[model samples]
Target: MSCWKYWPEIEEIAETLEGLGAENIDHIDELNKIDIEEVKKQLDRIEVIAHDKDIDFDSAKHILDNERMNKALKLIRKFYLYIGARLETENAQEIIDSDLDPDEILNKFHFYERYEGLLENESKLAKFNENKTFVFIGSGPLPLTLIMFRKKFGCKCIGIEIQPEVAELSRKIIDKLGLSDGIEIIVGDETTIEDLDYDILMVAAFAEPKERVFANVWERVTPKTPVLVRTYSGMRAILYAPLTDKQLRGFHKEIMLLPIGNTNNTSVLLRKIE
Candidate 1:
């Protein structure tokens, strides 16, 4: 959806609210001018309102007019949320302190996954394996990919999730399907932890933190390791981590736009160089 691309704008609006403070409603009309359409947009608004609860009121308003500073602040907040969600999903506990309900946020994330045309069938898991190791980042509905990758590829997997319920559900599904032997899921914090090596790192769209994580992994891995990333749509690798032919590892780099149903997932495969 176009909303995915315009998430930055929504985040900017949230920064405005962050600057406005909870009690500062003098300009509430100006803020109310923005239309409330989907859950994603509403969540952005809620995130800003939630910020007023903890942030100093005066400091929040002081930075209101500073567009650049606000933008940066939103990114930082976004990253924090990503880290918290990953922890919550992996550990099955909520880590972030926020006025916004974790259930509400998770629901919106699920809505995004449903709308993005992610996974639908079991056969897609044909490539998964229980022997080899793999990691799935940003479990925004693409954990289905992990399920399939594990089944089809016969590889062991660790799913790095941002929502506890989602992660739990994925784990349950794996168990129900009798595929638990190969999957080990964890929550990743962006600000901490060194990169963990894996045969592949499967990423999904709308995962800003995971995108950065991939770049971090690339910087650390030896030339022989391979990283296969998955994107929902758009010029994936080009927009995020573009690897040059010279920079590519000896393994291989592939750009694939696979059709799931009515939608398509554009994924880039970057193998490590040995």
Candidate 2:
């Protein structure tokens, strides 16, 4: 089951969050005061809710909709990811300084197993091993998805991160992982779409202003190049951005893969007929 922390205390959390708080959670000082174990516990609790036989999807969704619990849930996830990125950067730098193998640290990452599960589901729908070039937006400091794609399929992976410092850190960790040759990280935002040439484009769930990013890619990406948007819905929409049918109305082909609770985002693939 999916367990999100503080699922029961959503009202208090929501009150703590200011306006449009999810977008600015990374810089929230009060959130930083939250103990790491507390964050982990909350996430664990959230995951378990998804698997509770007594709670159907609709019931869980209703809970989130009550008192705008969804906002608090999303704030927790954004905070979780931001803290995770910072922790990864610190630990990775230590490993690099020691000149030790980066494998152990990478393999033990918080979302390592979750990412593996996501890729398994993705490969079932997309051509990951057929020399496909993947461009992942909002790779953050770890760029774990791009790294996994390169190592698992031996395919070329390009990560476009909006934060320059995060992109620089991603490059450092990737180089330590000995994947610098296979993965490339560039610093730019949604407008970077015009500069990339890839067979597959994947947008990260955490990428902000999701609508504008989708629109930018739609306008500039090559027709028929499959654009896979990572989204969430139902109760899981609390953990990530939700995608609507309205956002994907004009695609010639549309496919959505539901997560089995081990992961967060639902992969939505859209292709233009050209």
- Taken over the whole model, the C-alpha lDDT of each candidate is 0.46, 0.71
Off by over 4 Å in 1: 1-130, 140-142, 162-166, 190-197, 232-253, 258-261, 272-274
Tens-digit lDDT string for candidate 2 (60-93): 6666666656556656567556656666666666
In terms of lDDT, the poorest run of 10 residues in model 2 is: 13-22
Model 1 lDDT vs. the true structure? Answer: 0.46
* Residue-level lDDT tens digits of model 1 in 159-215: 776667666666654555456777765665322224555655555554565445655
